[model samples]
Target: MASNDNDNSLIAGALFLVAGGIVGAGVALLFAPQSGTKTRKDICRFARKARRSAEDAVEVVEDFKDNLSDIVEEVGERATEILETGKDMAYGAKKKLLKALEESGEQLEKQRAKLSKLVG
Candidate 1:
């Protein structure tokens, strides 16, 4: 969800920048005192540059999205590995505890039997 929000914000920001560039270009063309031919050429150049900038921005956003996805995947894999290791360690400890308990019970039984035999 947070990633979704970040993606939305990035797209919105890009759109705003493009919109602002277009408005500024329009205002500049209106106020400039150049001949029609020169103005037309300038407009064409501005359009091309704007297109390139927009394309570059898109590529940057795509790269960032891909990087974020890869990092998330790696983190998930690491967490799973850690969880499995923890489970294996716990199982080993439990087995050791049960074995010790069994041995203690057997010792108690032997001591009780010896004491009864001596008393009788």
Candidate 2:
């Protein structure tokens, strides 16, 4: 869980960096006062750079998703193992309890027969 938070923070940081870079470039282009054609070219080049950055971010997200899936699978398998272990322990305990009860009943019957013989 802590790692997820750290990952989210990293992703947010990357997004902020990308946004700041785009904003900085726009401000620079607007303040430079170049010819219209040159300004358009600069904007196009910056757009390409932004696209690549976005693609890289997307790839990172995809990889994160894959890793998360694997983690979930591992957790699920572990939970199943824990559950089966608990069930096996419960079954053993139940068998022991039943056997104890049966023995206790036999001892009680023997005691009652002895008391009847003494009273008679």
Candidate 3:
């Protein structure tokens, strides 16, 4: 949980820095004394750069999501295997206990028969 909070804080800090840089660059470009055509070209270039940056961030996010999904699936499969193994062990133990009880009962019956014959 602490790691998650730290990750969130790091992401927020990075986003804040990127946003500040973008805002500063826009303000600088707007105030620069340049011809109308050059200003328009500069604005278009900046917009293209920003779009590329956004696309890259999206791709990174998508990849992270895919990796996280795979990790979750693997954990779920491991948990299921562990659960099945536990059930099998329990069943084996129960069978062994029942067999022991049956053997003990047979021994007891034999001793009872011998004792009765001796008394008669």
Candidate 4:
């Protein structure tokens, strides 16, 4: 998944570089003493293409953001469930220990009473 993101970033960067180059070339042409009408037309065309490319890039970034958010939420939920399960297990173990201790104490008291009866 990380590699995929890296790949996407690289592709987006390359596309931006190409778009910049196109705009730069168009600007250079516009300044090179061309007919005013032709220069305007060329600039308009380049502007439209650049706009489309930028919108596409925005869409890609939005999709990546949404997917990352979903993954983070899922991980958070799983972590919470695991924590709850651990707490339940700990509580059960503590209860079992307390019960065992109570039983042992009762047995000791019974033995003491029997011994006292014999001694008295």
lDDT of 4 by residue, 1-120 (tens): 895787578667857776887778786977788799988888888778877877787777768777877898999999999999999999999999999999999999999999999999
Residue 35 displacement (Å), model 4: 5.2
Stretches of model 4 off by over 4 angstroms after superposition:
1-25, 32-38, 110-120
Compare candidates 1 and 3 on lDDT and give the better one. 1
For 3-84, candidate 1 gives per-residue lDDT tens digits of: 8899989977997898799779967986799888888888888888888888888889889999989999999999999999
| RMSD values, in order shown | 2.4, 5.8, 5.2, 7.0
- Best to worst by lDDT, what's the order? 1, 2, 4, 3
**Model 3 Cα shift for residue 109 (angstroms):** 3.1
Clashing residue pairs, backbone N/CA/C < 3 A, model 4:
none
In terms of lDDT, the poorest run of 10 residues in model 2 is: 3-12
Q: On TM-score, who's better, 3 or 4?
A: 3
TM-score between model 4 and native: 0.59
Task: Go through the candidates in order and give the clash count of each.
Answer: 0, 0, 0, 0
- Where in model 1 is the C-alpha error above 4 Å? 1-9, 117-120
TM-score of each: 0.80, 0.65, 0.63, 0.59
Model 3 Cα lDDT, one tens digit per residue, 8-118: 675566566667767788888889999878987897898788767766765675577568768979999999999999999999999999999999999999999999999
lDDT of each prediction vs. the true structure? 0.91, 0.88, 0.81, 0.84
Per-residue lDDT of model 2, residues 1-120, tens digit only: 886787788788778888888889988997897897898899889979997997798679769868987998999999999999999999999999999999999999999999999998
